[model samples]
Target: MRRRNVLRACLILLAASQLPSPAQAEQIIRMSTTYTTADSGLLAYLLPMFEKRTGAEVKVVITGTGKALELAKHGEVDVSLTHARPAEDKLVAEGYGVKRHDVMYNDFILVGPANDPAGIKGGKDVIAAMKKIIAGKARFVSRGDNSGTDLIEKAYWKQIGDRPQAPAYISAGAGMGEALTMAADKEAYALTDRATFAAYKAKTGLVVAVEGDPKMFNPYGIIAVNPAKYPGVNYKGATQLIDWITSDEGQRAIAAFRVAGQQVFFPSAKVGR
Candidate 1:
């Protein structure tokens, strides 16, 4: 009973005026997603198709993937789209999520000034490339927000033995685009997803120096919050949505997505990344 009240208050607080009005004859599905190019990345593809085919109004709550997952965990939203694999796996394994589906993939690339001060360019080994960045002590920008990118960056540093203290190293508790902009402003290096980097590259003036390394591969996964864990969740609608995303039409939409003739993200359903 207490939990029910808490959930109600949360929804009321977050409830958007954009939600369908009572007279609108529209169905709203609240979706949580990362503060990603999701505006142009997945939602730009899937939401339109879903709405066109189903006549439902999709209400999106844009935030970090971590915050999105938290919304799902609390039954604050119907679904979550995220790129953090280990976090997703933990949620699925712990019964907070159900029906995991591979939506798409893009590799993470280390972007630096065209000068390539760290000499990270053309380094096939990700660890070796990372080590060079550290050894050079060249200014490297980090998201540092416990975001998927930050999580992966920290994991990479952990894989290496001892890293220099995080002093001159800059931490931007901001989104990918903002962090990329920050990197560009300082003429520094940053790790970013290919899709966002490609979309914002021209505006930011950063160049991709290290890519094609297997470790740089980033895959996106969709999961419905398990109704059993958070009974307030819309299990039926969530299932329907997840089913559509993993289907051929949805997968094809993901593959068809491109910006300026550059295919930044690739479909990862039939094969592994």
Candidate 2:
């Protein structure tokens, strides 16, 4: 009887080995995302849940939106999460992106010293606030790395037709977190994503000087790298991730994320499916 039991166990083990392993089999999906996403704590909260649900590992590469899109264009990543709409559209137009899906949105805010040297506090119009900053020559720190925030800042500058003069305009060539930090240290003004700014708010001591302008709206999108361009790209994993993130579950998770109990990112994607 004992021999028969042992034989049965061996047969069961053999059958289990023959069956397909986990669907992902611990496959790793390479993902690129903007620094704002990483610094805002969204990625940290969502990735682990996604990994647990899919049985797949995600390798995240954090950088500016331009760099993230470039990595996806080269197929160095399976998907990219970024906020630069024009550049993201260009990626798809150029055939490097398989598809783009709206992920989430927040708004850009002008953060400056508590003293309000530019006197932009309580302003509802972003353009007017920018004009005030430039006119006042208030010290301003710029994330000059061509990030999504930087692009928006440049557009505002173009609208006013004058760049912040030297000594007043300090280009940090860094991420949102660093730009905020520099702005705090220099007691300058900066344009930053609300989520990232909130995350670093306690440390930076910068106040939201201006907001509520429609032009300050910031949207994020996720793009799956084109498998046709790079045959080795993990298209399956990318699709799964995109589908999951756009699903009801993922949208709720994003909405639930907060900083200091204040919801930072609002779910903007179409729910379901």
Off by over 4 Å in 2: 1-26
**Number of clashes recorded per candidate:** 0, 0
lDDT of 2 by residue, 1-273 (tens): 999999999999999999746564427789999899988898999999898998888899998888899899998999999999999999999999988999899999988999999899999899898899888989999999988888889988998899889999999999999999999999999999999998999998989999899999999999999989998888989999999888898999999999878899999898864
Quick one: best TM-score, which candidate? 2
> What TM-score should be assigned to candidate 2?
0.90
lDDT of 1 by residue, 176-254 (tens): 8889999998888888888888878899889888888898888888888888887766666667776777777777787
**Which 10 residues in a row give candidate 2 its minimum summed lDDT?**
19-28
Clashing pairs in 1: none
Tell me the lDDT of model 2 at 153.
Answer: 92
